[model samples]
Target: MNKLDLKVLDKQEDFFIINGKEFNIGFTNAEKERSFNRNTEEGIKELNSLKEEFGANEVIYLKQIHSDKILNYIENGKSIKDEEADAIITKEKGIIIGVFTADCVPIILVDEEKKVAAAIHSGWRGTYESITFKTIEKMKKEFSINVKNLKAYIGPHIRKCCYEVSEELKLKFIEKKTEIKKEDLFCGRNLNLEVCILDDLKKAGIQDENINSIDLCTYCSEDVKLHSYRKSQGSYGRMFSFIILR
Candidate 1:
């Protein structure tokens, strides 16, 4: 599905990160002809490797629908896997929760003190709905997490360099988020979706330094083998952004 013009890496490109000894996070690369969707043979194999590599017990996935709905492992438990949601959050350890994305943003939120982590799939729709801010609010209410302790890692997505939008869409977004000036959202015909997310995070009390953004643009990156939906000529595979409390 995801067409790669460049030579594939000889091995897996592990974008692994460790936040002390509390958790492990990773974003898989499209270096190999692999898919992480559940029940697929390729997905199963790749996830097995992920479970082993991250020392996680079970891999958590959901029927993602690009909505702002959030699944909580503590309140709803594991059965929420069959549900449709754009975000998943939990304080439970040893289980890996992940989201699949091509050009859409995948966000990982972690509170080291509360040992709670969340994975959010924020496409333009979810960003417009403020899914990240809602996830943080849920985590705080459920687990009593301190917002200042939350570290948000925004995964790779289509940036403004290549994200061209229509005037009507820009006007709609500006109308919804009155606080955001027109100039901040648009660079000529291109729109920066991350600016809305940053504003949401700041409003939700996530500190500036605590927010980590992967500056790679999925649509135009020459070095990284990322799948981009906007660049998808019919079919485009998805990359995995996962986190586990170790």
Candidate 2:
């Protein structure tokens, strides 16, 4: 199989498209519109447009809690409520699986053979909890995918340059045995969250060549195309990462 090609779609929305699939992922500004708050109706509408554009049928997703729990999306011909989970997987084509993020990492996995896909939200909690690996393991077990055949993508989020974590959060990750080398742990002033998640992916058996971990710093992007919880403080917006097998 060829290496996966990752492309940016709707940069204004911080949206992305995987080359071989029929789904899309993007971000939204919650502070700008009251209706767009917390993956609101407006955001869903934008996502639906992408689905329709790609000729997808149904959408599936999770209400991310930054935990390791992964849900399977069963097609019911309706939008799924944001249930508490960090990851969601599905084999049903046309079911869009979405996950919301601000600074946290958004992960997508696809099995070319089985036609199964996943959308995962990984924050420090989910990273320390190893949600990414857990999700991959679950997919492999359920879909019988060879680890090498699975393709992965890590979307734009907070980087080490701006993701500041107190000593407490750092210690928590260290306790979980996540390899946060001292150099990558603190970038003069902030913790490098990208490093933590990247290391986790490698540990989970994803080859380095198969992952497209964008280096875009949401906090420092002068264009303001993507949302940054750190840059905007607590009043920031959100970006949605979704995928559907088609």
Candidate 3:
């Protein structure tokens, strides 16, 4: 199936080898025209199929408001239904956690040693609030996850190639992330969310070598099948990216 084509986290050692290179983390494409938004019949069916595809009972997600609010699956009694958060952290196994994204970053973090994992949705607002960094801090506090042993997978999203922002927004972002050089953060008025995310991850004490990113840009990648909100002008649907401690 096209969903298995990317093999997104195959290069990483965080996943268990359940069935021959099978991964616990996954990033899905727009194959079969699936949206996984859960607001319609097709979306509900697609989301359930994803549960089957990942061999998990359910997929936990958030009613993302682009804020830095993070949730703990266990604290919610090991199950959540549309929690108001941007990131989810879980230390349990076999229960999938995920986020929906279009032209926004979908980040999966794992502590292989401790069997803890997290799924984060980071857009421009989330980025400004240091959502990725805060998620790591929460994981550390909740699960005692060591940043050095944490592996991160940054899935495809709108990069600087097709993510030009307004001058005021750019200035606000620049004002917040003063550690990164302006030239490195921006490509001539096009804000690079990847760069911003990288800085956040690094600042959170995650080693650079443990961080991996899909080079494809959702909004501009010619050959990639991932969806893009800006490219579709918000007319289409979002792709789901998830991870589990399987």
Over 136-224, each residue of candidate 3 has an lDDT whose tens digit, in order, gives 99899878888888888888889888899999999998899899899988987899898888888988998878887777788777655
**Candidate 1 lDDT:** 0.81
Put the candidates in lDDT order, highest first: 1, 3, 2
RMSD (CA, Å), each prediction: 5.1, 3.8, 4.6
Writing each residue's lDDT as its tens digit, candidate 2 over 48-141 gives 6656765677555566667888887777644456568888888887666777777888878877777878888888888777788888889888
lDDT comparison, 1 vs 3, better candidate: 1
RMSD of 3: 4.6
Candidate 1 global TM-score: 0.89
Q: Which pairs in model 3 have colliding backbones?
A: none
- The TM-score of predicted model 3 comes to 0.89
lDDT (0 to 1) per candidate: 0.81, 0.67, 0.78
TM-scores for all predictions: 0.89, 0.83, 0.89
Clash number by candidate, in order: 0, 4, 0
